[model samples]
Target: MQDAAEPPPLRSRRDLVKELSLGMVAFGADARNLTSQGNLTPAQTRRLLPAGLVAAIGGELVASMAYLAMGRWAYASAALVRQLVEVEYLAWAVTNDPDDAWEWLKSDRQTRLQRWQPGKIRQRSDGRFPNSDYHAHCEAGGHPVPEPAMNILDHRDQWVELSLYEAAVHGTATWHYLVQAVGDAPVTAAERHHRLIDEAHNVWRRTETLDRGFLSPANGSDA
Candidate 1:
């Protein structure tokens, strides 16, 4: 028996990865079942963009876990950036008129770029950014926005999130490359295992928020 004062042993990294993988698989299945419940009309089918975005997020999460297992932290970080993009896409889908959102999603790069060009993106009176302001948009749409949506849209840590995402995708930060070179050497195996567990928990939390806010029966019907 272990001493009462001692901390419990950490689970293996493989176990952590397996747990995360299983959770994602379950989420994917749930999303599929949710989307397949009833025959959708043509307009409804077009509005399935948020469901597609949720699936995209699941793919990014699985890719992130794969990269982490392969000791490719930078690639994993880049996957995280893609996941954030999916979240933004989901927000855009739920908040706007479905037809307009679908048109924008299917628009060519040049057309999309023209809409998002400098001076075109306006800040609202509530201090929220255009198109991605979940709180404001949800209120306007008479939908209840989830806490995660508000948390992310509040922009309190906007700079930090933006910097990390930019560094991961653009290789702008030296540590991004340096950490990949160093691999997991900076921490003990147990420490690394715990880190993986923490990362998995964060991903699950975000996934739950997305499911509840945009993919549940009540909310998904609107999409």
Candidate 2:
């Protein structure tokens, strides 16, 4: 029998984008919708989480390559691409951690919010973190044990939400300019894209550490 033919090679981010397109189709109708929403259905989350993670990385590469290839610049698309990376990382990180991580991801708010005192979640008379849901237990970043990162994770998740919102604003503004300009202006876009790449890399590493039990008793991070 003849030997099997060699597999094709990935030549560029454009190629990766095609690969992502395949992975994204696995998400069915909600693939595009889920990218912007705060919460995902359990079924959608299960199918899209891995694809989202890969998509984020692939998007970054595409943005970088496109930015560098440009003689001028495109700022808005670049920023959107970067923000997307952080957003995907946050989703993936939270979904993979915590006992009820999926439920956490399903929340309109990705983290538990409450007043924290010392190392515990403090109840408030003002009814803060309204309609309290998840317990105060978060381990993302380098937060040690006996600490109320439930509050912190809530804050971080909020920030990610806000960042993406701002990104959408800028993106809308730039898309108009990009259309008028015939193509994108690459200088500003490249700058923002590169910066976000660094930030995304750091966030991924930090979250991955948490996923590996960075705060566990065996890790010497437990307080």
Q: Which one is best on lDDT?
A: 1
Q: Cα lDDT of all candidates, in order?
A: 0.36, 0.31
* Candidate 1 local lDDT, 109-215, one digit each (tens): 89767753322323311333333323322432224335433433453233223223232222111111212222222212223434554564444333221222221
Candidate 1 regions exceeding 4 Å error are: 1-38, 69-72, 75-79, 116-223
Model 2 C-alpha lDDT per residue in residues 1-223, reported as the tens digit of each score: 2223422211222233332323222222233455346465555454344433434444444444334323222222223344333333333333333223343335453244421221222132133221221121123222243333343234443323322322322222222222222112122332333344344333333322122112234323333
| Window of ten residues with lowest summed lDDT in model 1 | 170-179
Clashes of 2: 7
Residue 190 alpha-carbon offset, candidate 2, angstroms: 31
